[model samples]
Target: MLRVAVDRDGGVTLDDVADATREIDRVLEESDVMGELPFTLEVTSRGVDRPLTLPRHWRRNEDRLVKITLVEGGEVTGRIVASTEESATLDVDGDTREVLYADVAKALVQIEFNRKKKQNDSEDA
Candidate 1:
């Protein structure tokens, strides 16, 4: 299945997914990119299980707890404090650690069902 994940400043709704699917279908029908291939599409919002790979991904996950695997084989578990294009600052056991994007091999948001929602920015799937 072709998965289309989308997010917004507030949140994504069912209608948003339906609208996005329709728009994608319309665009593909107007173009020859698929070359008569019949394909099924599944549109979804970003899931917490998805790894944090890009600067925007890191930015989107600010304040969430994460487990990061370093390129040098080090592992870090911390709550995201701040993030930029090049690095992320995490609060690791009361100590703040700064990690460069290049040093991160993989990063995934940790699940915390009892976690309090920060302002209006709660990470959603």
Candidate 2:
């Protein structure tokens, strides 16, 4: 069995994995290869935490909050200040600015919306 997930841009989320698994299943069904190999396939997005280096990645996440980890071990959290195919700039620590993507090792969108209510509820409780 193979499962597939389509992204906002209509990109194949896990096409390679799904396709390969399906092909193996087909061959096993047809030829009885390796005494009936059982297989399962799942395809899905990288979730909301996908990297934001590609221009398409940033476009899919416009207006969202993101966290960027610099190669130098510094971290910057900001609303995706601005993005391009080449790099992304971040508004960090209020007024501080960082051009992150070019030198970043990792970048992920932060789940900020849910955190606010959780914080408020904890305080009220």
| Highest lDDT model number | 1
Cα RMSD of all models vs. native, in order, equals 4.0, 8.0
* Model 2 quality (TM-score): 0.54
Candidate 2: residue 84 lDDT (0-100): 69
> In candidate 2, which residue pairs get closer than 3 Å at backbone N, Cα or C atoms, i.e. clash?
none
lDDT of 2 by residue, 1-125 (tens): 64655456423445555675577657667775445556564556647866766777865675567877889888777765566677665656566464635688888988865644434456643
- What tens-digit string does per-residue lDDT give for candidate 1 at 1-125? 57789976334588988999899989888988878778888889887888988888888778789999999998999998898889999999999999998999999999998977667765774
In model 2, which regions exceed 4 Å deviation?
9-45, 93-100, 114-125
Q: What global local distance difference test value does model 2 have?
A: 0.64
**CA lDDT of each prediction against the hidden true structure:** 0.86, 0.64
Distance from true position, residue 57, model 2, in Å?
A: 1.1
- Could you tell me which 10 consecutive residues in candidate 2 have the lowest summed lDDT? 4-13
Model 1: residue 30 alpha-carbon error in angstroms: 9.3
Query: How high is each candidate's TM-score?
Result: 0.68, 0.54
Backbone clash numbers for all candidates listed: 0, 0
Pairs that collide in candidate 1 are none
